[model samples]
Target: MPVRSPYPDVEIPEISLFDFLFTDFGGRDAEPALIDGGSGASISFAELRGMVEKIAAALAERGIAKGDVVGIFAPNTPYYAAVFHGILRANAIVTSANSLYSPGELAHQLTDSGAKLLFTVSPFLDRAAAAAEQAGLPADSIIVLDAAEGYTSLHDLWGTTAATPAQDTLPTDTAVLPYSSGTTGLAKGVILTHRNLVANLLQIQQMGTVTGDTRILAVLPFFHIYGMTVMMNQGLHANATVITMPKFDLPEFLRIIADHRIQRVYIAPPVAVALAKHPIVDQYDLSCIDIIFSGAAPLDAELGHAMGKRLGCTVLQGYGMTELSPVSHCMPDDRPDLDLNSSGFALPNIVCKLVDPETGEEVGPGGRGELWVKGPNVMVGYLNNPEATAITLDDEGYLHTGDVAEVTEDGVFSIVDRVKELIKYKGYQVPPAELEALLLTNPKIADAAVIGVRDDEGEEVPKAFVVLQDGVELSADDVMAFVAERIAPHKKVRVVEFIDVIPKSASGKILRKDLRAREAAKA
Candidate 1:
């Protein structure tokens, strides 16, 4: 039996994302749609739509046609939103690369997505230009959002008098290409359609209490789906004011939140640790926050409760992957009493089945299994990688989420850990995410990651890589003792290594592959 959403299905419109978000402003035309947190610059809904029109007109004039893919490699900003919608308005697709990507990484995405043009800022020109060259795009194809000498600037694009192209995109048309390293492999582009994006917006609107008055703080990078759909698009659909930060600086982040009087703050678990324990957090008045919704990683329940207590707000969590347009299950804004560990009920139009990974047997409530999701928001397939797509999505159209999860009889779902990342200690499974979350609760530990490593007998065991707070002294023995007292023998940390920082992805996922490579180098 499939686990269906508790809420009734919401109607998704058969239109492009451009029509879904930019069409209906009404009284919000004069209101601020986006704001730059650093410079305090704002663009009203009317102004943003104008920019989108001009950029679309320019793109069409420059020969950008339907089905063409444009690349964006910039950080979070008010202009990012304009360009993002502008590409769609021109009936083109967008393949957004992580701003922190190197030339090789960006080039890989550009080449794979067959991007015809790129959008970036002046500060990132060096990397973007190098990637553009590697991807075989002409020098004239690069457009810097901020003025960069010699390159085509946003002002140049805005100078076009050409008419915006008519919307030719269908619901099935591909919208955005975001790369994700599925269950196990190299990074591959996840093909999200316009219908997928529009479906998620309608689905999310029913879960969160985001109204026109809500202020969303978008510090997360828009290249990732968590930021793309959850923070940016969701804000636009609700007609909420979205404040964008180019990058994360602790002091700057706090100041922006305090200054903007933001109501809804969406964050990954890493930021929650800072909000809960960082001494500098006391300097800011964050009582304006009404809901701190966490996604992208499993948040520790204790840390979530601590942050909520300190800030006097509701702390909620959600679960999704890049393949799911990033959200299928989330705690409703009103359900503050729900356990922080659970991702709450499924959104409308989603059916989930928990199946045993090894046996292929369906597991009901109270049993752990790989979560297979069937929904309208599920991605059609991986871009140009049929083999990979076939491995993930089944004949039934359910995406076999590589993550293991459990559901309560009441329909509450809790994500356990990635099936591939789970550690096997003497045949007993030990979840690294659980260990990492527990490590974050320690007062002296700043951050942590756990991966399975072979001991002297070639037996796999959980080894912890810890990042200590500045000026704090701790030994490997001390760390081992701390964990040994906490859990079962099989789950105890057998090896401990302290480092300056834990390698993590842009979305705050621990880059265990990098850690595994490091261990392999020693071997």
Candidate 2:
């Protein structure tokens, strides 16, 4: 028997995401819905809705329509939200690419998702243009949110005399396509439908409190499912103000929380390290913060406790993945007393099972096993990859989350380790296969395998186990620099060790567990 959520199930309404989020403002039309923390500019609820309508009309004028996939490859900003909803309001699908993606990386998503157009900021125009050309999208399809030399601007997208397009999307229609590595391999688009997103919003609502008075901080990139659903959409669903930061900077993050009087902050474990131990954190007054919620990776209880004690706020943690629409378990607002090490209880409408991977038997409370989740918030499937989809989601409607977990009889779940080969670096997914493939491209390297290992600070970083070609010389930094130049910063090879051979199975699969054992022995 599967363990169910402790909380009452939430009613997931049958509606499109646009209608679900934008249909009501509840008389706070004049209140700020989104604030740009860097520039201090804001967009009120009324203004944002108006912007959405005009942008949608402009997109329709440019031939975007139902079933069309549009890409948003920009950072967190009030305009990012506007364009995101505008794509949906235009009855088009959104494939949000990571803001840190290199041109090649962005092109992969664009080609894979079949995106017709891409929305980006002026600062990212160079990369956007390169990716667009590589993906076979015309230059005219690149729209800059702000000023650019010759590209279409958001200003151009506005002031359309044409009416906004009618909403043709159904609850079951695909909405946003955020790519994830899932259990392993290269990034694949996670097919989250309108209902999947809406269901997650409602399910999260039953687990936590986010009133209109709450001010959520969004420093994590909006491309990741954690920030997309929990920080961006959840803030909108509650009609609360959300403060946006394009990237994480310690002093800047501290200042934004103090200056904005932000009540809630959603961060990964790494940020907690900065908040707890960084000397600059003491200079800022963070007394206004009410809750500091951590996700994406496991949070150390001691670190969480230290951060909360320092800031005089409650520290909480949750467990999720891209395939579960990102959240199936979290600590409730009222249950701060639950072990900070645990992910608290399963969220409403989530049914969880722990199964022994070796024996194919269900494991109860005290036993460790892989977690399986079934819920309304689960994704439909991976886009255009039925084989990968079948491997992740089983016939029983459960998503076979590759993370190993343990649960108590009371329904509390704690993610202890990952069964997948992907490494979590500062909350970003770094797929080993992607890195291994990149390493093989180097002429001096004969073979390579990448795995996660703890650095001095205890954060996970990708370490390359390499075999060099005979008579060739390459330093550790040389290997790191080669990979850093070719991939996004997060996927950079941090540590490198030249070895004679990388352990492999008979079928030619890199035995990651053997590499992990070697790492353990070294430690």
Candidate 3:
């Protein structure tokens, strides 16, 4: 009836996030835990543990308590681990905000999550303050990771008396609230409990090999679930030295890999494309890299093989979503005989089923269907949105992943397509509904439909089909600029076309398939 993981189940500890990651430093405390890629600055494991305790005390002194929500709106930095663990140490939930979000976008998440405190950096203070004001958070609630004129610095929290260990929290309590557009629609918070995160960490550990000597390069944004669980938490749990890059820059990425002698890299398909085709890759020596693991989007097998061949490493892929605590399946480092095109087998303790979307019958091996998964790694629910949660997580506890996939007789899974309408731009979720709503705000646009179309780079981008008002003229550049001003850079509409009518179903739903066919014809 269901396909099970090939590996044995892992033993997940019933502990807080802080205890799980920071408690067992062992003899590696003096070693570097995190390193800043740009300046080569580092934080030792012992120092990081101390900082988490002290910051937890500071947050408690500021009236933050168990069940309170705190926001981190900064990029990947050496101090990020300290701040993130400190929030958990204080027994508060951490809601990571996208650093690239516009003030309005940031305000929505802060307001929706009911965050009382926001931890940010110097460059983002102005926007953070704006968002804080909009969310009704006081100026004093803003703490700058880097010291600023009026804001509190992380160092200022160090001398305070450390707070006692986190109170006994049930493993079922929510630990992180990273938002995602589950199947289709606007973004909603995905409630991942402590157990959900811990289970995923343990599951991934069982599926792959990561030891104390592993050196990982973290270029993926930590705000996304993929980076948070796979790179940040798992790296720490495995006692690896993680090198953080604030953003992706090809030359800088190459330099960091060479300089750090990074042994493993976690990436998405777009980055894999760049590594495979970019001419500058030959300039650096990447022989130290042992594994290149790709996730967040489907990667072309040829591209993965090409990159692996060029870098002299093993290329692998995994598949999951924000609602599944981000990862349910991954390619094992030891499984060199598996197909590179497949996303790999389920992680230990995970149960996956494929059911025909139209007939609602279970699909056997070699047949395709929408994938449904049941595991400890699945999310608790969407925060404050029970209806959406009900639609996603069935009464039987299986999560509808909204992905069409096929399973092999040996339990390997391969994603074929998405049943939902969410567009992924370089691993970032861009909802078509969000873009359609924004397009309606333009004066000249009468009706519009947004769909993802691939560009020359093989990356998905939001393409808008607009029906302008009768006798009104608007340039495509003007339409693009209008969306750019209202949304984040990744959500911007990169392609536009003027059409007279938008195909719709009898139920008044946009026929996205028709639009996709039109785009395919043009291509």
Name the candidate that leads on TM-score: 2
lDDT of each: 0.89, 0.93, 0.91
Residues 19-46 of candidate 3 have per-residue lDDT tens digits of 7888787679999999999999999999
User: What C-alpha lDDT, on a 0 to 100 scale, does residue 224 get in candidate 3?
Assistant: 88
The segments of candidate 2 whose C-alpha lies over 4 angstroms from its true place after superposition are none
Which residue pairs in candidate 1 have backbone atoms (N, alpha carbon, C) closer than 3 angstroms, thus clashing?
A: none
Kindly report which residue stretches of model 1 are placed more than 4 angstroms away from their true locations once superposed: 421-523
Measured by TM-score, how close is model 3 to the native structure? 0.98
Candidate 3 local accuracy as lDDT?
Answer: 0.91
- For candidate 1, the C-alpha RMSD (Å) to the true structure equals 10.2
lDDT by residue for model 2 over 178-247, one digit each (tens)?
9999999999999999999999999999878898999999999888888889998999999999999999
Give the Å shift of residue 58 in candidate 2: 0.8
Better of 2 and 3 by lDDT: 2
* Candidate number with greatest lDDT: 2
Please give the ranking of all candidate structures by lDDT, highest first, separated by commas. 2, 3, 1
Candidate 1 C-alpha lDDT tens digits along 354-455: 999989999999999999999999999999999989999999999998889999999999988567776655433466876887788888999999998978
